[model samples]
Target: MLRVLIIAQCALLSGVLVAEVSAADPGSRPNVLLIVVDDLNDWVGCLPAHFRANGYETAGAGKIFHHYQNHPSSWDDFWPSKNLQFPPTHVPAKEYQPAFDRKPRPRNWYMDFNWGPLDKVVEETGDWMSMKFVSQKLQEKRDPSADSGQAKPFFLACGIYRPHVPWFVPRKFFDMFPPDRIQLPPSKADDQPVAAGPTQLREVDAR
Candidate 1:
């Protein structure tokens, strides 16, 4: 089943990200797949609690919720576990080395601020691992061993952590669009200002 969420300037209340899912098939309990993304100009909500409360089995991986406000009760299981919140970075935290050529800048979260080709394979990254886990779950069949003798409809939320920051993508993707062939979008000084408020309050390196 396919559903689209249209969200605009909506606040997250009671630690739940709420949004309307349109075009759902009537009278059928279809499995839900909630794919949340980070650093995108759009926003969304948490529907796992509601689905679970209504007899759905909830599971999630990656950035389903903000790293700090994860709701463990909302999910039957979550990736990176509830304690870890986020998956391990492509580069281990302890072994990370910052750019020495540029002057040190003060910031709240400074790691992974630089971008370039990663020396590692895509399979070695946390995002790839999370995706693999989700794929495995999707392919799983209902277990007859359950007490109910049947499996409940699943509400799976997969959070993709890319196109956000630290664009250490594999060289192949970057190679597809050569820098010389890239064209800049037209802009004007008189254009209306972009969305700004609490969302844009933080410092992010979107290079």
Candidate 2:
């Protein structure tokens, strides 16, 4: 009877192990939430994109980091350049001028104006407007079951444009990093490397 009890216990343990393995398999797809933030560098508290892109399963505390990072085929697609329509007069002398110069100055039109308590006269109005617009869209897509009656599982992407100059963000975010407290990135004054080709030379010069 003692031998029979041992055999029964072993069988129960085997079943539990099998169940755990099945739950942990990668092929067993869970509800995927793909949040791709455009032009977002490795700055956020949850560096999800960096981990997933590099095949890192988890961070220090066993928290899963499953965000994928994607690169644009063309440089133009890197940012919503076309969306910010430039005036005819703003066009550069050269047909294919550098992207930095090609970008329209004074005002960026790519940002939405609606869905915000933003001041039109504020210098960082565009940034505030864009954040509000993106946030609203995120709530709509992610929390669809709340009021929209859409209960389907979704892969929602929340893209935010930031730390990209005109370095525009709301006053609250700006206030977080005071100029005196801000530590600038280290740069080498005389660290110029030779370019491999004309194309490489042009790219280096542009930078």
Candidate 3:
């Protein structure tokens, strides 16, 4: 029987293998569903609620030397990151809205507060077309009638690119973290300033 386990944790870890079929067998490998979110460092809450609820949050980069390695035996076959390709250039809409619908910032931002359903962000942004591709792959399921009436188990890995931009997250997410309720980083009196060039003074000062 095919069983599935999805590791929703931030780290790209391949957990213990439950079963190992013969490599020579036509059905040896488990059906793989891959997901790679580009520039996704912080926001991972876009995943299914159950997976997020039981997930283990870590720095995720604890070990630098062996971080992204996967067990060779985890799958008989595998595909590396697919969304590594750069996104298409974006053209702003004629009429623009800002986050919280508050006011559009002078600098263009992908996500600010024009909101709708959760998946609406994926639906609307052409730059984020990769999300729709991943969604379609997720929808494809094994047909029980085909394949000798036996359904093969699958190993699906879904990566949510929430923290990554163009931010385009739902409006509810913005409401969830209003400016007042947000936490600011503590300023340290002993913080040291690095040397910067005259040309980069404005950019460095902003930091």
- Top TM-score prediction, candidate number: 1
Ten consecutive residues with minimal summed lDDT in candidate 3? 57-66
For model 3, the local distance difference test gives 0.31
User: TM-score, each model?
Assistant: 0.57, 0.23, 0.28
Local accuracy of candidate 1 as per-residue lDDT tens digits, 95-154: 333332233344423443545555577887778888987887787744344437667889
Model 2 per-residue lDDT tens digits across residues 1-207: 323332332223222222322333324423111121222233331243344344432211100112122322111221123233111111121322343243433223222111112112343343344445445545665564665553433222223333322222344655555769988777564653321122222221232
- Candidate 1: global Cα-lDDT? 0.54
The 10 consecutive residues of candidate 1 with the worst lDDT sum are 1-10
Best by lDDT: 1
Q: Between prediction 2 and prediction 3, which has the larger TM-score?
A: 3
Q: For candidate 2, give the lDDT of residue 43.
A: 31
Which residues of candidate 1, in runs, are more than 4 Å off? 1-46, 92-104, 142-148, 175-207
* Residue 42 of model 3, lDDT score: 27
